[model samples]
Each structure stands twice: as C-alpha cells, then as structure tokens.
Target: MAVQASPQTLAPFLIEPRFVPRVWGFDDLRPWFDWSRFEKGREAGDPLGEVWLTGDDCHIATGPYSGKILADVIAQEPRAILGPVAPRVESPLLIKVIFAREKLSVQVHPDDKLAQKYGDPRGKTECWYALDSQPDAQVAAGLKPGVTMDQVRAGIQNGTLEDSLNVLPVERGDMIFVDAGTVHAIWPGSILLETQQNCALTYRMYDYGRPRELHIEKSLEATRLTTRAGKVLPVSRPDRTILVDVEYFRVERLPVRSQRSSASLAASDEPGPGLSYLFAAAGSARLTGEGFEPIEIPARGLVCVPAVGSAFVLEDLGGLDLVRMSPRWPAAI
Candidate 1:
C-alpha cells in the first residue's frame, strides 16, 4: 500500500532511473551511466537498453516525496506537478536514454486520433537528441519516397523491410524528430536522449526473428506514407540551445560552467508553470533552494522540479551540461 498523505513539502528532487532489459542492448551502460548506481536484478540477465528518467515507476530520490512512486506524487498534486495551465494528464513526458547495441523492431506509433479511437490517452511523437555516436551510425525514419503500403506489407512478410526504410546518419548533438504514424527503427552506434509523450503504444511492424509479437494489423493502420519525421535544426542561444518546442513538450540545452538560479538555470520557469526536468548530460550539478534539502545530480542523471514548488539554485559541481525538459498542451484539448 502507498501512503496517501499530502507531500506538499516536496521540492525539486532527483528521480531514480529505471533500467529496462532488452535483447538488443549492451551488457554495460558506461561513461553515460554508472550501472552500480541502480539497484540489482534490473538487468534480468539481459543487456540493459533503456534508462527511463521520468517513468511513472521511477521513485523520488530526495525530499518529502522520497521513496514514493512518481505517479502517486503526481496524482496527489496534479496542479503542482503538471502546472496550472497544462493538460489533465497522468504523465507529461517520458524521458529516456536509449542504448541500443543492435536494432529495435521496425515500428510505428498511432497518432492522437487513432490512439483515442482505441481507448488510449494519446500517442507517441518523439524527438531524439544525440549525445554520442560512432561513425556511420544511423536510424531509419518513415519510408523511402514512392514506397507504398503494399510494398511495406510485402517487405515485412518477406523479411526485407529495411530496404524500404529511409535511413538517416546520426551525429553527435543532432536532433531527429519522429512524429506519430511514422514507421521508424533505432539502430546501433548512438546514445540517444529521447523525449516523447507519456504514452507507450508502439505498433511493431517487423522484428528480425526475435520471437517478439508483431502488431501487423495495427501497424499497418497506423502507418503513414509521409510524415514530418526527419532531422530538426536547433537554434543556439548564448545561454541555451532550443532543441524542440513541439505540441507536447519543450526541450532546451543549457551550459552551466558556474552557479546560476534555477529560474535561469532551467528552461521555461519563472513567469510560467513550475514543472520541469533538469538532466545532467555531461558533468555534475547541485540543486539548492529554500524549504528543501539540496540534491546533487550526477552525470546522466535526471531531476524533476514540480510546478509552483520551491525555488532553487543550480550550482555546477563540474562541467554541467543540462537539458531542461517540460510539457506543453494543445489548444483543442
């Protein structure tokens, strides 16, 4: 049973990352994350592939909400965690660090309309920020120009779906957007920071004889011949780099070589909502503010700040490269 007591005393705090095992993952997630920092048995005898930063199962690592499930905290203080003008949703964003040693299944994600038709909250539309990549690293997004649905079906059946994929080379610091309804796949040689809608409704089109269930019918129905899925150019500023400002999320990259206010340290704070995520992509950072215990974010670690919560200051313990992520709602909703 979970404690239902009010955790209003909670301030901006660290979020424990959840490591999920995958067939195509690496045995060790190094340089980026300290595998020992995570609890045991998470690997499950398989190579770990993903580190979910803001997942619902992720527990609060500090302050009043320490040891509480992320979902429970949000449910108890929706307005405080989701902001005053944000949508009424369980989770605003699912931030993850993907470590793929091989290739993921050729998949497609349903859009909002298709997802809602199947009694789901919303669909997935993700953007990837490449943190590290080897030479010739690649990802497949959408289909080759002039490729038809019939060809896709035939390719999947004949096990040649890769031929129809529109492959893109990945480089460090690149931003790639994958919209809903676009068939996509993640390949090896790159470390990715993925920001997406909270929903995880993936429709796998094809897997390389991996014994995984394939969602052929749903994937076909969700596939689109053309989508706005490709490399997105980022705008660089003196203090931060604006990565993506899509309908569901806003992401920014900040360089903190010294101390700064949480307002200036993070993105989309101050005159707006209170919810935000500060990810230490490179070095270490320490967060301090009134009414809350100070918390430190190590390399590849994530921290969450609630809406209207306590104000804080981010001090750079080393070469801190932070990625600030937050949510935005659509007008029609």
Candidate 2:
C-alpha cells in the first residue's frame, strides 16, 4: 500500500498578473530566454512565475484550502505555523515565480516607515532564484563600477542614469539577493523564484518608455540616495542548504527523489510562534500535519501550513524541487 501522507492545514496558492505594455513588457522581457516557450507578445498563465501561492484573501488565485485560512488556523496553535502570526493576518513572506521576457523597471523599494507613510500595505524586500535563463540574459543590480550615489542622482537629473547602472548576465540556478532600497531590476530571458516580504508596493526609477507612466518623484523619495555598501554581487551557485536568509524570512531549495519528511527546525518550547509555506515547483508531494487533512500539492502548486503541530513531513512522489519558506526571524524594524 502507498504510504499515507500526514495531515496538516493546507491553504491555496495565488497568482497576480502584472501585465504592462512596453519595452519592459514580458514580450520584451522574453528575450532573456529564461522560460521554455513563448508565443509572440504573450505568455501562459497556469504556470506564470510571479503568481503568488498563499497570500491574504486567498482570492487572486483561489484553491481548496481544505481548512481555515492560515492566519485563522494559527490562532488555535502558534507552533502549528512556523513564524509569528501577526495581528495583521498577513504572511511575512510573499513567494513568486518570475519569468522575465524583458528587463523589469529600474526600481527601489521602501522600508517600513516610508511604506506606511506612502500608504503601502507592505514593505518590499525580495530575493530571486533563477530556474532558467538564456545565454545573454542579464539583470540590473546596484550601480555600475565606481558610480557614486551623487553621480546616480546627477544622472537622473541629466537623463544619463542608465549608464551608471551595473548589468550582470545570469543563467539557470543562479540566485540574486535584493534588499529594500537596493537599486535593481530583472533583465529579460530569465525564469526565477522570488521570495519576499508580503508587500506589493514598488517605486520605479525608470521604465524604458513603457506605456505605463514612470513613478520618478515617488521613486526619488523612496530610493536610498546613498549608494549601498557592497557591489551588486549575484549568488551564481547557492548551496541548496542555505539559499537566502534575511530579516523577514528564509527560503531553501530542497529536492526530493523519493519521500522525505520535514525535520523539526524549532522545538515547541521555543518562545515565539512560526509558519511555513511549502511550494512544489516540480513533481508532486503530500503534506500531513497534526490537525488537518493530508494535502496533495501538484507540480507548480503551493500549500500553506498554518498551525503545524510539532512538525510535518513532505513525502515526495518522485523527483521534485521544493521551496520551503518560513518567518522564523525576528522583525528588525
């Protein structure tokens, strides 16, 4: 008999399309050649990367959660989830699959204070994991070599800022770290996973003449005028063991060939609460928790474990890439 999967609170996945017309459109973004196929100015939806799996409202792209929303289920038990379930009912992390057909806008994200000031629902801090990429695919990261913040501001004023930005080529399996206030944009011909705080507010510094109007003034105010400390380095080869660790959350890439169970990351006695978001990028997996139904997550789908009692196991049907994200970090701001 097949091994019975464990039972746990399983929630649906969400995908919100950011369709824009222009030089930055996925059509233009497609030259990055990160995905498998495209049909002239159009991309498929069922498997779009930027689609969010388990977010608030659970409506953008709903599913059979099989129980209450993660936030609600967590109320009965804290350890059931991996991180602190906040009063706001928002998951600390916003996970996405990003398929770039063209370069995204040159943009900067705001910190919490500025986010609230600007009426943004969440602060944006994100990281990228390249699933595929074309030979010439590249990403715009930080400033060009030797360019200073003052020089950047001057370029903005003189319309020569593009020259001051650093562009780097990328390939499949590459990882990029993007912090709030970091000047960056995704280049075309690349497919990747983006894990970030649960915020959608973006301040674009440049749009390359897309039909959408640029947010220059807001971008100017939100952007960190001072150049960031380090060079815009890309993590070409990340140890799947530790992919990206930030103040908000942690994203790890785990591949399972057979069946694997989740190792306990924290003990119940641990002080604060936690939550976990499991994504099946490839292949199917079964999720079992203490007080919920055993959920079957198909390839490219995701499930949220709201109140995980003790720990849960991920039984891989065969070959698969799993993205496990959690908010175990204390809020810095």
Candidate 3:
C-alpha cells in the first residue's frame, strides 16, 4: 500500500498519540491529556503510563494524510517525509512521554551487534529530558564504579540489586543520556520526554520481587560494569539551548519570546535538508510555512515539519516553551 502527497498535502501536521497502560501509571493524566477527549479513564481500565508521540501505529491527525498510520506513510515516501538524507527508510526515532508512579524495572538493553544476533532490528540508546520532577526525585543511571558483572549477578540473586546502582538526583529541564548496556531504572516523581532509537529490547535483571519473567542470563551478558549513562550538560545559544546531540538525535529548547513577528525555523541556516519535530512542552504556538495553512499546536501537542515541505516560521500563540528535535545519522553512514 502506498500514498502519494500532492502539493496541498505537503504541510506540517499533527499525529495522534497512542496511550499505553501500565501498572506504574497514573489514573489522571491531567495536563497531559483531558479525559473527556479519551475513551475512558480509571473507570474503564488500568492507568495510562506512556503516551507515545511517534509510535508506528499512530495516525496522522491533520492534512491530506489524516487517518493514515505513521509507519505506512513513511514507508511509502521515506525521502519526501523523512528527508532525502535520512539514514533509513522507516522512522528513525521513537518519542514518548514517560510517566512513572512507581519504579520501572531494573534493566539493560543490548547494543547493535547483540541485538542483531538476537534477531532484533537494532538496540536501544535513549535520553531523558525532564518535563517535571518532584522534590528529591532521582534515577538509577548505572552501576556503582568498579562493580563487576559477578557482583551484579550476586546482588540480583540476593534481591539487593538496587544497592549496586549509582543513583543520581534529577531536576526539571535536566537531560541524561542512557546509552546501551547501561543498567538503569526510572523511579517515581518525574515526567520524562524520552527520545530513543526506534527499538525496544529490554533485558530485565530485577523487578523488586515481581512475579514477572526475568532474563538474568541475557541481562548479565549485556551488562557493563561502567557505562556512559549520567547527566548531560546543555550547550546554550542566543536563540535556543542544545539539550543533547548524539548519533541518534539532536534536541534543542526553543523559547518563544513575545514577538510582533513570526520567527524563522531555527535550523534554517544549516545546510542540506531535514525534518523537525516541534514539541510544545509548556504552552501553545503556531507553525506557519509557504504553500500551506497555518498549523496550531496546543499545549503538550506535537507536530512534524518535513524537509520537502516549504520553509516554515513559528509564531507565539501563548507562552510557548518549544523543544525541537531532529534525527542525526552517523558520519560513517
């Protein structure tokens, strides 16, 4: 199945989000989602923990592509939608809002080599940019320095694995990188915007005695005593703040000042063509471009600007705190 985009169809648009139910989720998403717009709330089923912005099954919410699945759209016209320079045809990144009421599983993810060996597409290397955090909120990023794999296995068996983790305090607007092979867990108290490679291969080592299945052997094999997982410092610019730029993706914080005129796309000066994801983390804004109608993004809404589309400008509708994320391919590729 294939769909072609006419001139009228090539415009920045919105994609409906997919909600995932989790035991560690909250009953009321509140500011993130209005229950009135959803099917049902706590009365119907489990609490909602994650709202996936770019899931494969998510549908295009606006323009000529409306009602089409994201994966199918990209598969049909990868270069037109994802940019001619995109590393792969399919979507390269998965963006999600992670809400945790309880701790997540103490787990590790494989790298590209190990993932391919296990018949998976790729590995998971993700970053977290805090949207909100409670006082004293912290996350277990990696193992304590010099903690060997033998000790990690012993701790898991003894139900003392948490003690071996190096817990780091997290605050709002902080960015942390969690590369592959990092033993990590997200505890209660923060809402995180997670950007990662489009892969989900988790090997759980411990789960606080939960009855769920464990992958001790594979986890130990994928674990690293010391990992490149910790807080990330931002590189500030006059117009925006570069949150994190890795081989997978680059995210920046664009603060919309109360201006009389629209502002040009932040990356308009860069060479080559690419796509941009505008995430309204705090307030609403408007996206305008040539050959298309103005698209308005509500608070917490997400919109995609394709490379083949016309040059775009952003206008402040309210106090807009926008985060722009774009994919980054390896230089070797």
Candidate No. with top lDDT: 1
Highest-TM-score candidate? 1
> What tens digits encode model 3's per-residue C-alpha lDDT throughout 118-229?
8987888899999999997899999998888888989999989999999988899999999899999999989999998889789999998677789999998888888889
What is the TM-score ranking, best to worst? 1, 3, 2
- Give every collision pair in model 3: none
| Model 1 worst lDDT window (10 residues) | 1-10
How high a TM-score does candidate 1 get?
0.93
lDDT of 2 by residue, 178-201 (tens): 777777878778776778887878
lDDT ranking, high to low: 1, 3, 2
lDDT of 3 at 287: 71
2 or 3: which has the higher TM-score? 3
Query: What CA root-mean-square deviation does each model show from the true structure?
Result: 3.2, 7.4, 3.1
Model with the higher TM-score, candidate 1 or 2:
1
Per-residue error for 200 in candidate 3, Å, reads 1.4
- Residue 55, model 3: Cα distance from true site in angstroms: 0.8
CA lDDT, every prediction? 0.85, 0.59, 0.81
lDDT of 1: 0.85
Give the residue spans of candidate 1 off by over 4 A. Answer: 1-10, 40-44, 265-271
Clashing pairs in 1: 274-307
